[model samples]
Target: MTSVVITGKRYLTKPEEAEKFGPFERTYLAEGDSWMDSSAWNQGSLPEFLVRGFNRRGRSRLIVNISTSGHTLTKIVDMMNDELVWWLNQGTYDALLFSAGGNDFIDAARDAPPGQGLLFDMRGKPMPANGYDCVNPAALQRLVDYLNVNFAAIYQAVRSSGKNAATPIYLNAYDTPQARDAPAIRDLAGPWLYTAYTKNGIDPALWDQLTAGIFKDILHTITAWADGRSGVHVVPTSDLLDKAVPGSTGDSKDWVNEIHPNKSGWKKQVEAWLPLLS
Candidate 1:
C-alpha cells in the first residue's frame, strides 16, 4: 500500500480519550467490542496487515482512510456527503476501508449499566470491584437495529457516489475479549464504564466465557444483514483469536492487556485481511 490519507469531519475530543481499540483520528463509528478503544487502528499506527500490503511487490495500492473518532450516523452521512466528496475530488486511494458502529454499541452498553460501573471479570461473575450493571439484551438490540440501517446507507453512499462499487471495501467484526479478568474503567466523569482487559490480574476461565459465543452472534447478525455483497469482506476475529483457544490457559498467544493484540495478534489481523485484499 502507498501513503494513506483520511478525509472527513473531525471530532472534538482527544484521540486518547477513546476507549475503543482504534487509533482513529476524529470521527469513527464504533461497531463491535474491539472497536471500544481502537487506538491501534488509527491513521498513524496502520494495522500490521496493511503494512504488509504496502510491502508487497505488486501494483501500488493506496489506503485512503477517511474516518474520525466519535462520529455518529448523522455525522458520518454529512461527512461523506460533504468532506469525503472533496477527498475523492483530490484523486487519492487505490482502496478504501470503512468502519463504524462500535461507538453505538458502547453507547448501548452504557444504557445497560446506566449510572453504574461495569465491575466484573469477563465471566460475568463478581470481581474484587464487582458491583455494576452490564450489557442487557434490550440495549444491544437497539444498537443492532441502528447498525443495520446505517451500514446499508454507508454502503449505498460509497457505491453510488461515483466510487467503484467493486473497490474492495473491507469491513470488520469485533473481537469479543474474554471477560474473566475485566475491571470497571471509570471515565473522567464519575460514570462507570466497562473495564479494559489488563494483564495484571486476569482469570483465564473468565476470559473464555466472556469471548465465547458472544462474538459469533455479533458476526452472524451483521453478516445476515449484509447479504454477502461481493465488495464487502468481514474479517472474523473470533477465528483469529482461536489460536489462543479461549478454554486453554497454556496458549501463549495472549496479549499483554488481555484485550489488545500483541505482535502475534496483530499478525493474525493482517492475515485475516490478506485474503480479502487479494
Candidate 2:
C-alpha cells in the first residue's frame, strides 16, 4: 500500500516513535526529506494505532503525519495549505486521516468560566452565565452553520491540493470528558468543564446531559456533512471512549486532561480505526 497522508491536530499527531514500526521504518512522504528523525517533532507523538496496526498488517507503509496538539481546525487547515501540501506529489498517498473540531469546541476554556448556561452554546465561548438550562436553537444554528462552512473550505483545500480530490478523508466525533481536573497535572490546565460547572454549581445530571447533548449535536452535524460527500468518511469514535458519569468520574488514567486521551485510552480509539487503517 502507498503511504497515507495524515494531517490534523491532537488525536492525529505523530508520535516521535511508532513503537514496533518506528519512524525510521516508515519513509517520509514529504519531498526532499528522506526520513523524519525523532527530533523533528517537538511534542505530540505518533498515534499508537497506526504503529501497531501497520506492523501487524506487515505492510511497509510511509506515514506523512502532520497533526499537532491543542490546535483548532483553522490552524490545521492552514498548515495543510502552507506546509503539508508542499511535501506532496499528486497521487502519492492513499488517504488522509483528520481529527479536528474538538479543539474548536473545547476552546471555551479560553473564555473564562461560562458560569452555568448549559455548558457549550455551540458558540465555542463561555455562554451567558445566566444559568439557562435549555438549548438555544438560533445561536446553535449559527455556530453549526459556520462550522460546516469551515469544514467545507478545509475539504475544498484538501481536494485541490496536489490533486488529492480522490483521497479519502477520515473524520470522527469527539468523546465527552469528565468534569474534573486537579492542580497537579499541567497546572490543572484542565478537565475543561471544571471551571464552568464548579463556578456555577451545575447539577451533576444536568451537566452530564448538557455535555452529552452538545457532543451529540456535533456528531450529528459532522455525520450530516459527510453523508453524501464522496471520499469523506466519518469514523465513529464517541463510542470507543467512556464518558464521565454524574456521581463518578471515568477512569482517571484514561485521559491526560479534559479531552486528550491517555496512552491506553488512545489505544482503544485506535482499535476503532483499525478497520480503515488496515
Candidate 3:
C-alpha cells in the first residue's frame, strides 16, 4: 500500500499518474483552506498527515488536493463550481475531505465599521457578565446561517454528480486555538486573533474563554447540520491537541503558530479520522 498527492488539474490531465503509485485501496478528493494547504510553511497539515497514517497501515490511497490557503467557505463553494465539479463528474472517489470554516470565522473577526464584524467593540461599555458578551450575537447568527447554506450547496453539488453520489464526505471540526500574537511567518501572514481582540477592546483575560465559546457555537452548528445526512461525517478533532498558551507570541504546546498545529499536533488530529476512513 502507498499514497500519492496530486493537484486537481494534474489529476484531470494525467489520470494515469495516480495508477503509477497504486494498486490502491481508496482515493479521495480534498479541498479547503490553510489546514489542507500549509506545505509552503513546511508545517505538517491534516491531509499530509492522513496520507502518512494510511501508508503506515498498508492502506493505499490517492489524494487529489485542490486546497488553497486562507480561503473562506464562500470562496471554497465558488471553487467547487468552477473546477472541482469537473473532477466529481469525471472521476470516482471513495471520499471527499473538506477543511474550511476556520478562515470564515477569522475574517469575521477583522476590524470593520461599527455595527459590523463578529466581535463587539467592548470599549466604552460597562464590563459584561462573561466572555459570550464579547461577541455580536446577530453577526454570529448571520455567519452561522451563511456557512450552513454554503455547506449544503456543496453537498448538493456532490450528490448531483453521478460519479460520487455515494462517496462519503468528511469534514473536520478544528481544534480551539488561543487568541494570541503568533504569526505563521513574521511580517507576512498573521496574528489574526490578536489584532481582532485588541481592536475590539476585548480584555486579554477573556480571550481564551471567548474563543472557546465561539468555536463551540460553530462546531455545534456544523455537527448538527451534518446529523442524519447520508455519507457526511464530521471528524471530531477539537480535543486532539494541547491548546496554545494564552499570551505566548510563538510556538507553544502543540501549536506552531496562532492557528496551525505542529507536526505532532497534526499527527494526533489525524488519528481520529483513521478509523472512520478505514
Candidate 4:
C-alpha cells in the first residue's frame, strides 16, 4: 500500500523511483488537462486521489501522469507525436486514463469570430424556451464531433501500440459548474463560464440551466461514443458532486473555482470511478 503517482518527467529521469514502492498490482498511464495536473491552486487532483483511494483499498497502484494544465483535446492529440508514444509503448500499463473535453468546451465558449464558437450572439434574438437555446446547435455539434474524432484517434493510437494493444482506456466527463466569477487565481487564470455567459448576453437566471445543459450534452455524446467499444470506459461525473453556489466568487460547496472541484468533490468522484478501475 506504499504505491504512489509520479510525473512523466520523474518516471523518465529516475525509472527506479517507482520500483522502490515495488510490485504494483496495477499501473496506469494518464494524460489529460488540469483535472489530472495539480497546480498551486489545486493541491490534489484526480490522479492523486485515485492513488490514495487505491492504497486505501489495499491495492497497489502506480500512475505515471503526463498531464498538463490548460491543454485542449487537440493539444492532447498533438502530444501523441512526442512523449506520449514513448510512455504508451514502453510501459505495461493496465489502463490509460484521460481527463479532457472541459478545456475544449471552455475554448468554444469564447466569443470568437462568426461560426467559430459555441455560443450564439443572443443580442437581438427572441427569448428562448430554455438555456439550451443560448448555444448554437451547429457549433455545439461541431465541437462534440471534433472531440469525438480526437478521442477516437487516441484510442487508435493505444490500440496500434504493440505493448498496450489490449489496455483499457478510461475517460471522465466533467461535472456541471456554476457560471460565476470564481477564478483559480484572482485576476490571472479564469472565471471562464462567467465571461462566456456575460459576453453572449445570456441572462443571469439562465446561466445555471445553460451550463448544466451543455455538460449534459457533452456527457451523453461521450458516453454514446464509448458504448459497445471494447476496452473503453466513460466515467460519468456530471451529477456526482454538489454544484457551487450561484453568485459566490470563491470556493463554495464542492467546487474550488469555476471548473475544478475541491478535495471533497474529488473524493466523491474517485469513489465512483474506483469500481470501474477495479
Which residue pairs collide, candidate 3? none
Q: Comparing 2 and 3 by TM-score, which wins?
A: 3
Model 3 TM-score, 2 decimals? 0.94
Note the Cα lDDT for every prediction shown. 0.43, 0.54, 0.84, 0.84
lDDT of 2 by residue, 1-278 (tens): 32233332321355433333443333433211101111223212334345555666766665555554456666655566565565444334566666666656545433434522334333334444333343456556766777688788777766777657676777766566665643224453444565556555455445566666667777887787797788888777786666534343333555544555555666776676667755
Clash count for each candidate, listed in order shown: 34, 5, 0, 0
Point out the higher-scoring one by lDDT: 2 or 3: 3
* TM-score between candidate 1 and the true structure: 0.60
Worst 10 residues of 2 by lDDT: 30-39
Q: Give the CA lDDT, 0 to 100, for residue 258 in model 1.
A: 31
Candidate 3: tens digits of C-alpha lDDT, residues 38-113 = 3555666777888899889988888888888888889988878687788788789999998888888888987575
Model 4, runs deviating above 4 Å: 40-43, 111-116
Q: How far out, in Å, is residue 278 in model 4?
A: 2.2
What are the per-model C-alpha RMSD values against the true structure? Answer: 9.2, 7.2, 1.7, 1.7
For each candidate, give its TM-score against the true structure.
Answer: 0.60, 0.71, 0.94, 0.94
